[model samples]
Target: MDKPVLPLTYEQIDHWIASLQPELAREGFTHAVGILRGGAWPATLVSHATGAVPAFLRYERATRTAVWDSSVPLPARGSKVLVCEDIAGAGHTLADCVSFLREQGLVVKTLTVVFDDLSRMRPDYGMDCRGYFALLPWERHAYTDRYRARWQHTQAGTLGPIGEDHEFAVYAIDLDGVLLPDVPPHRYDADLMAALEERDALLPFEHLPQIDFSRTQAIVTGRPEIDRARTADWLARHGYAHLRLVMRDPSRHGEHPEQVAAYKAEAALELACTHFIESDPVQAIFIAQHAPLLRVVWWDAARRAAKLIATQAWRGADAPTP
Candidate 1:
């Protein structure tokens, strides 16, 4: 099953950081040590808020090591310091960093943007984000398979598996008009077999949507399942074979716009996809209506733009027509 995702916006992160200011001031920290990469942002903010000297430590996750920056000389022994991190997952980075700081005789208190209940090292202060995969605004690419593989590699022999249930954004995208030029319905109606063959031969669209194929989990298409072989071949040839393809069931539904929309909506729900991108505006509206919680985006192929279709406005009888 796909993990549930908690998309964190800048406003939300700023608010979280702001909430820590009062306590940070009370702690009377002399220095704010940020773990590099993810931790640096929050550490800088903490420094700004608490008027503490900002310091950095480069942490290597794979090697489980932390090295202090050469320019920032070590703080005097016994000085109060707050270590900041973005998130405290089941990792050894925080523990190792804190241990290294304490070894210098500095008083170390850990702070993180978020920490799960199952985290190996709970921060002295953090937003309890148990069970959800918190997607940070700056590190949107962190959820990709490659990133996960790296995480898994470093986490081997750890407490729990990374694939365990957690919240994460799952994206489902349309194929025909979104990924490639759509063979007009008229052409398909005129010569179904010939149009199918032509579509199979056509290359991907030049100005496709700015979707990260690595993060995209599924492709929900209106094409019938009988065409899976050709569809899979097309996707593989175009370097998108890793994505799971959900094709229309010819035995259950016809090629009507409404039927197609329903099929796509059902597929999105079954896949637990948080976002669905469709090329047809009408179908986009229909899918949003069917799955009110699902985020739907209408991809304009010509303009190469994506417009989010809000489902709330389409909920009641007073809903505006598309």
Candidate 2:
């Protein structure tokens, strides 16, 4: 059994911060000390909201050392300070930082965006996000295998493998019809080189799907890997350079719809994506059939609507006409 992930958006964070403002403003905090990196976002926002002098402390997880950032002047002894962190999990960072601040004779009240039941130190203020693996938008790259390997190297002895322990909202999308117009097959049949040139020239659709590209983990395309250069160029030109592009193998080029769907299903599984958005209804259905647990959405470009495929049963006859 895996812990379900709660994908958090910036809007949700903003809302959480907003909800904290009135209470934080009432606290009359003199200084805001943000834990470096993740904590900085909330701490800076809290400072702006409460008029607290901002400071930071960088904590080295491996060394269990907390060092105040010398660039920002430390809060005066006896001054009331509000310490902020992104999360207070089963980690010592928050506890240690609070202790360090208290030892300096500063009055400290802890704050965090989220804290679980197993947290080492419960903050005075934070949302109770127990049970779920709270995935933040800023740390989206943590879903990668490399990051997991790093985590295993550093903390796996205590925390276990992140993938097996937690479910994540990794998303995959189709490239051609979803991001841009699909180059008509007839165009390619007529003139392969000219069609490739036309595809390379085609701009992203004027009205694209309502997907948050920030959360889109990969672009799975039926286009052969031979078009990698042009596909990459188009993606980069359209401000999606950061996304991973998975193309059909050159050996499997010109595969039929069933083969293409198989390739997509395999890619989705390989990537461990939880959801997939596809442009073709048939492909979407096939993907859902192959990966029953995955949430597949069919994007109807012409209708400007997205339909969720709830059942794995094939309903090609019911599929909307292109």
Candidate 3:
């Protein structure tokens, strides 16, 4: 049986942070270092509570080393530093971070919300974890991106090869916000390109409960064709493989944002799937307007909620006149 996913709320995080007050009440800590993206929020919370200066320790995947960003100077000699992470699953990240801090000649302490039983490295403080995957409030974007099953009887299985007359419900899904959290558009710069090239970022989003990959007919995404390799790797790692993925052909349409909507609408119309789950509200609305016969379900990443947008069964008479 698949393990049930436990979604942790902000209130739960606040409670856990409160529980660690007794352990962190000591007076010697000079700085609180966050382990980049995942650790930033909790570290900030700890810093706010304890009055410690906040800093970042970024992990370089290519080098497999954790180093301070140099923007923030290391603490004074013999100063105590508290490190925070959202979880200590597999123990690799925190372990590497602690080793890096120790090498810098600073006293180090670790804090994590969830501690996996199988992790080789134990944290200085952690809450008891009870699920295969713990979705932190900060990671809620992922939970919202997953396809929630409305048809429970649909068994999980792979979509057979295309061009065959397969008699199964096909769901056309948007990639970024629907199946995985989309990277913030503002961060599309040289740094983002570097991260992609390093293969250290763009990790796969965890699927929510009731999501069966076999139900996916085709993934129509706005991501450029250049990202095909990394996107494929991420999908395969997350158990989505051998399915038709339609990405924007930048060579033909260029990177005009408007072209993305047109491409997606074209794919949805061509597939004529039973449903299309989309993350972008505007795109979802566009799909509903263009493909009135197709049901559109909206996955709100910000609110972590799902809503049925539009649905109209198509008849042969309703075919578009070209």
TM-scores across all candidates? 0.59, 0.56, 0.46
User: In every candidate, how many clashes are there?
Assistant: 5, 0, 1
lDDT of 2 by residue, 109-175 (tens): 9988888767888899888889876667566546455566657675756654445322446689998
- Best-fitting candidate, measured by lDDT? 1
**Ten consecutive residues with minimal summed lDDT in candidate 2?**
159-168
Off by over 4 Å in 1: 1-4, 61-64, 138-150, 157-172, 179-217, 221-244, 247-300, 303-322
lDDT of 1 by residue, 1-322 (tens): 1556666766677888888799899999998999986888888889888898899999876577888973778999989999989888776889999999999999999998888756898899888788787767565545555446645664675534344222355689999899899999899889999999999999998887776665578999998899999999999999888889999998897888878999998888667566789999999988887766567899999998999985434257887767
Best-fitting candidate, scored by TM-score: 1
Better of 1 and 3 by TM-score: 1
lDDT of 2 at 304: 88
- Model 2 ranges off by over 4 Å: 156-181, 184-322
Tens-digit per-residue lDDT, 101-184, candidate 3: 988888999988777656667788777675565656555323222222311222232332222222244577888776666766
Quick one: ranking by TM-score, best first? 1, 2, 3
The count of residue-pair clashes in candidate 1 stands at 5
**Model 1 TM-score on a 0 to 1 scale:** 0.59
